[model samples]
Target: MMASALLAGSALALSACVASLAVGAAGMAARGVAGTPTNNEQAHPAAATDCSTRASHYGKVSIIDVEQRSPSKIVVWGTADDGKQRRSFECSYGTKITGFKLRPIASPR
Candidate 1:
């Protein structure tokens, strides 16, 4: 029980740090059952170009994973429309998109 409490506290701290630095601090949700990938076409462009939009479009964008917030870029991940695999993307803040990729779901052990 104490271990879980400690973990929760740590997670809260981490998310707070990420939120202040960037935008969405999604990590815990991604750790669970991730969303699947989709080729909906409509969401593709926004997911590629905008970080925040991608967070809403795909699912989770790990602002916490991002080291440098500014001119560097930020990465976010979430389940896709397909509802099978998890999609990870690196995009600028409403500027330019860098990369997008789909990763296999990590089932809970």
Candidate 2:
């Protein structure tokens, strides 16, 4: 009888843990912090181009990733369609775009 009670208590505790985790995950999803892209990001795939015109220097390109380091600084990763070269750009903005730097990233073989 004691063993049965212990098993029941364990099951109840496990269920409570699962429920709390589910609630936390749901809350994160609702706040757009669950690794899902925000609506603006989904709608504008080429938003990186706004940061630097050099993004198209190698011809048409596709943005791979965008990281906002702060309210005024952003980094973008992209690949050129011409030679498939991957590159990264750091952009700093003030009243206008103040700084832009390009860094070539070697692609994996």
Task: Report lDDT (CA) for all predictions.
Answer: 0.50, 0.62
Candidate 1 per-residue lDDT over residues 6-109, each given as its tens digit = 99999999999978766433554564456543333344344443655655466554443333343334444444433554554444322345655555556557
Off by over 4 Å in 2: 1-47, 84-86, 107-109
* Pairs that collide, model 1: 35-79, 36-80, 36-83, 36-84, 36-85, 60-77, 61-76, 62-76
Query: Among all windows of ten consecutive residues in candidate 1, which has the lowest summed lDDT?
Result: 63-72
lDDT value, candidate 2, whole model: 0.62
lDDT per residue, candidate 2, 1-109, as tens digits?
9999999999999999999999999998887854533234332234465653565775566666776655444556555545666666655443345566677777777
RMSD to the true structure for each prediction, in A, is 20.0, 9.1
